[model samples]
Target: MPVSFLSAEQRSRYGVFNAVPDIAQLGAFFHLDADDRRRAMAANGARNRLGWSLQLGTARFLNCFLDDPEDVPAAVVDYVAEQLGLQAADLKGYGEKEARWAHQEQIRTGYGYTAFAGEQWFALACWLYKRAWTTNERPIVLFDLATHRLVEAKILLPGVTTLERLIAALRERVAARQHALMATAPSPNQAAVLENLVKVEEGRRVSRLDRLRKSPTDVSSTGLVKALDRHVELRGLGAAGWDLSAVPPGKIAALARFAHAARAQAVDELAGDRKLATLVAFAATMAPQSADEAIEVFDLAVGDLLRTSAFKATKERMRTLKDLDTAAIVLREVWLKIRSVAEIPDGGIRAALDEMDLAAIHAAADVIGDIAREPDEDFQEELLDRYATIRRFLPKLLKHLDFDAGAAETPGQGVRRGHEVLQALDFLKAIERRRTDIDPSEVPADLLSSAWHRRVFPKRGELAGTFNKSAYTVAAVERLRESLRRHEVFVPGLRKWGDPTAGLLKGAEWERARPRICDELNLSPEPGTDVERWAATLDFVPPARRRPVRRRRRPQRLGTPGQRRDRQGPPGAHRPGPPE
Candidate 1:
């Protein structure tokens, strides 16, 4: 059965010369070498020789001989005839003779080419099946690769329709295998859940799948929370827990891409196995992706809060600038009046203050009290004001996403670095568990930066020995954000925000590839050698030989454009005077 998957253009061009061969193509495909020339010369006539040579070159070039052997590009005939030392007209009576059919068989047997059948056909099918199973390559790409493989193996190209059907059949087989593998992953109850994803529930306009497919539209606490909720819903499906390790990642990704683009109706229209597989793929792929996005949205939301706070602080400071100036003037006047007294009298500073405008001094004191909190004093206080915003999503983010401190440096020691951030995360998790009864003393003081210490643990106040809960939460979140950005702390399953060292070559793999890697990088196998080389490059220039860069001065513009003085000549020799 032939498949109609191939486009008309592809069908038209396959196994035939559709265009004139370029110089390179002509040289590569049609040029006869010494052995080819000897064989061509052995033919009885010019026509037989030209025809035989054409079959040989065409077999190598197109990997198939045309049915109407004479139906080829004029340039091809000319190029071949020229190489055979015969006129182009010599190919006219070529195929009319019985020798033409005999020459094809001769070329097949002589050149070690085999027809596409039996063992060769089965072998090709198996190879195509493996390729189709492992990759999500488009049909056309697989077709091209298959064509090349046949050519290399000296197997004659089959009919275009035959090959297309084979590809279509193999792809369908792979899809069925994938669908069967995934369909068996979920139990009957879980399968019911997958079906429910596509069906629109009561009071809802879109299906659950549609809602889950939609990404967060806004970078806000609300949006982050919503994204986290979707992630939770996906994880709740138990798709992550399913043993899809047997399925290829590419196949999973392809299915997910299809599911994301396809409408709920279209997905529901698929056969049971396919529909189940698509949903499972969508859920599995989207689980980690959503977690990564939620974290990203949280990061952006925090940034937005910081920016909004800083802008407000700036605006407030700007509004009070005039009053601050007035207060400074009033205080300066009072100071000068007191300074005139020289020494403290019986009334001390009261004598100077009595002489001054007491009313103005009182107003200045009020202004000082109002403007006492400087804008740049502590930005964390402004961030603390939005603690409610962070609170909305931080606990959920910490609860759902699993963070790690990457691999341990020493094997068996089990000590992961970035312990500060990791400990802070653990503390936050504990706080989330404790909720209202979180103990302040249990807070990781070592994890807190110096700036956060006072906020977390206040001295000489009623708040002492009891750290501010909001402040501690915000500070921990801020540190987490920074650590995540630096990859000191990473979410386990996320790709974007996941462990930085996950892709590194480690263990025996590193040892095997290290020599080749060092040679490629033009470095010695020893780390000390590379370090010394880098150090030498840095100090390549000696202090005495290194010259200071001379600064270029801008040329001064004199008078108007039409009246500028020319300063191009030597300093005093020929300076142009100003225009008259």
Candidate 2:
């Protein structure tokens, strides 16, 4: 049978009041569908219409008492009991079961107060909805099934009752948090938490704005757009507005342009900053058609941000550009020519590359890659000279590049430059080989290998040729060697370049060099004994060869005729042997 009302046995099993579902006693309640509610009312002895009215009234009084026991009067309880057709004598006999019946009736009817006026009831519903909304990040809905209407509910924060007021409060809070964040330079975790809190406040404002945007009955589109534009500016969202699916096509571009102006303001505020330079480079990539405009803005911002005296002071500190003290005027002329070709002089090249500030080089590379395709001989010659100079400086310059402290873009930037550097080197090498009678493969492997290894490896300032500058035990080295040999790979040694430690054999020389390394490290090549040297040792002998031992056969019993004949023959054989 379908469950109409929860019997005592059923309530003991599934009642919310028994355990309330959550250990913390959070929002927990029993819910019933409309059909179930109707059936529950019928099963709760509400067979007649008056019985149902009495049940609902008793439930309302009980719920009111549960919500505020001190506020509900004793007369209201007596009135509810009288409406339920319970006499004073019957009320005196009411116990836990009757109280449970009233609570269950409230669940069935979905009414906390049957006597409240329509407006007061709606207000109470709104208050309940707000309580649930502010408790968590969940969306709350207030719907009236009978009226078939939706109620817009808003949480009333301190001195902020309306949605507009709430948004203003959140916007102020975001500005305060941003100001505090800038003032205090907190730890990364602290800053992240503050940033997240600000985002949360911003999210609430966006949500409210979005709701307002949809309901044009009250707010005009012009006012809404103006408000949204200002919000984007305050948030520093620079050309980025999200959740535009509901926005009209005519409005998107205007909103995006408004947001992008914040990005422009950022350029002015954060001038000469390398991080901002990176952003401008990215903007240039994304908006290639308008790259000139963006680049011009970035250049102007950087120019305005840089102090003039700093340049003069820098030149004075350097004293001279040339390592050989050439004339200052000549050096300046040479520098102007170098700047015309967009090349960094040798002194600044290391600092430039080390910082992974490739914005300047990126422009140069693009120009070179594009222009090098020209068939003009003069242009090709000029390109070759410029590429040769760049290639010569980079190999030395890249060695001192600084990597980021944590898991940052430092590694990625280094790798990107490393690839570009190799391409130029190979291009130069191809030219050199074509000019002379040299083979391309004849390039110095050791020098190239060392440079390439140093470039990609994350750790620096450690001794070369070790697994992050840590020694390996002989057993661990052997296991690693066996694994590598099985896989047919020989990589760098596990020990530091000069550390007295067990080593790994690498490359084509592994077979020839293993025994020597073993000797130097004072380790036995054999598995168990020190006396047994490496297999390739000159005096080492292969283990002795051994023949299998023969087993003696058991004598046969003299039972069968053949056995008996063999026994007699043995007797005759003893006499024949004496004769022999």
Candidate 3:
């Protein structure tokens, strides 16, 4: 499709270039068209006679209890009534759904709300829309304008959070409670409850401001522009009254010079003494759609407000551009926090988060954020060089870590553990299932010959991680050897780097050292008695072999010292008696 024409759903989405449908046309099609193309609104003068009383307002909703705006924007009301089959007055005490219905009714019964009142999308559709950057950072949370309780927007961006990060961080905490029922897990619940309470308290003001911005009637109100404009006009008057000083200028240059002076004056008046702080407060409550424009308006409003403040206040609040060393640091910190978690997905944001890149993230954020901060040429040059260095190095580090972590957590490891734990668990389950009558023959040999018995792993940390600092090493041969040893099987497949007879040992001692040797080789274990030891020792075996000799026995026990000695080494290596 060329995309110039709207699909029924596309029109309703109002998604702009991003594939949202225009709601106006979509509604007409679904309701008026009888869900088909030809049946859609046919300009039937006879059917249009069906009348309605309508109420209309911003797409943003209101508190059911409060009442105001008595003039009630009659065109909006009438339009809403025609679409909704109700009067503008009838839609009071309703919600966002109701308000939208009313707006649509008006669209069907007559020309839409824009033909009479104004377009809801006007401010957002223009240059002012850029301010959404700041507003989107603030969630469109709601608060009781009265009791300061949750009335509409949530007090926090995640007014409800799953706290996956916090819970993951407390791995030790979970481990400590292994012996206790997990249902009794207390720390996560307590932390979540406390965090939510604090967020609600700190975020109420932000939510309220967001609610206000959602209302187009309020944001673009002539009253508001005038309130802001009064400061602009006063500053313009001040600039006209000022001495031009000895700056060279053509007519355009002179105009530019004057405009700066005027704007400066306005900014001094409004922002100098926190005069437009209230608007800033409002800008902070933003919904994603309206926030950017609202914040831009706030900036414009604040700049003008400050420039026109009393001269003394301007001198105090604006602060000279020369003293920005500390200001730069402050701005950087603020930008980092703001950019790191916002949904914008900009480069500056990528740099602030750890998962992206340590060096690159920092460098990218600095370049994106550090426009006017550095005064020292040398320092600026040094920073730029450092940024480049870190950018190159961090991506390398991130890639290496990603590859290493991924290798460690492969599905191979998952299958290895499954054969170990699940085979055991299922075996236990089967034994329990057949406990009443047991027989060795009844148990299939396949059960003992399963992958659980064949696959082995050496100690962790000692192998996969750095060698010197590691606590344990893991290897396939060692793990298999252990599995075999636990079952008292004969060790056979044990090899030194997959070669038979590569190392010194051959028999008993060789068997004992096989797993340790196999740890180095990454080979599977041969199931055998003392298999862990047998397989491990095989790599270390001496070339000499000896035949068994008959001898008298002292009544032997499983724990006797003769049994502890290497049974396959030179016959008399650890003699309890004459060579046997």
Clashes of 3: 91
Query: What does candidate 3's lDDT look like per residue over 115-178, in tens digits?
Result: 2112322322231222221122111111111112222221111111111222222322322222
RMSD of each: 6.9, 29.6, 41.4
Candidate 2 lDDT tens digits, 28-129: 222233543464445443233223333333332222223222222344334433544444333332232344455444544454233334664456555544
Which residue pairs does candidate 2 place in steric collision?
238-259, 239-259, 239-260
Residue 471 of model 1: what lDDT? Answer: 81
Q: For each candidate, how many residue pairs have backbone atoms clashing (under 3 Å)?
A: 0, 3, 91
Q: What value does the lDDT take at residue 376 in candidate 1?
A: 31
Tens-digit per-residue lDDT, 320-391, candidate 1:
999999899989878776776756455467756677788888999989886866343657667788988888
The best candidate in terms of TM-score? 1
RMSD of 2: 29.6
* Deviation from native of the Cα of residue 412 in model 1, angstroms: 19
Q: Against the true structure, whose lDDT is highest?
A: 1
Q: After TM-score superposition, what is the CA distance of residue 540 in candidate 1 from its true location, in Å?
A: 5.5
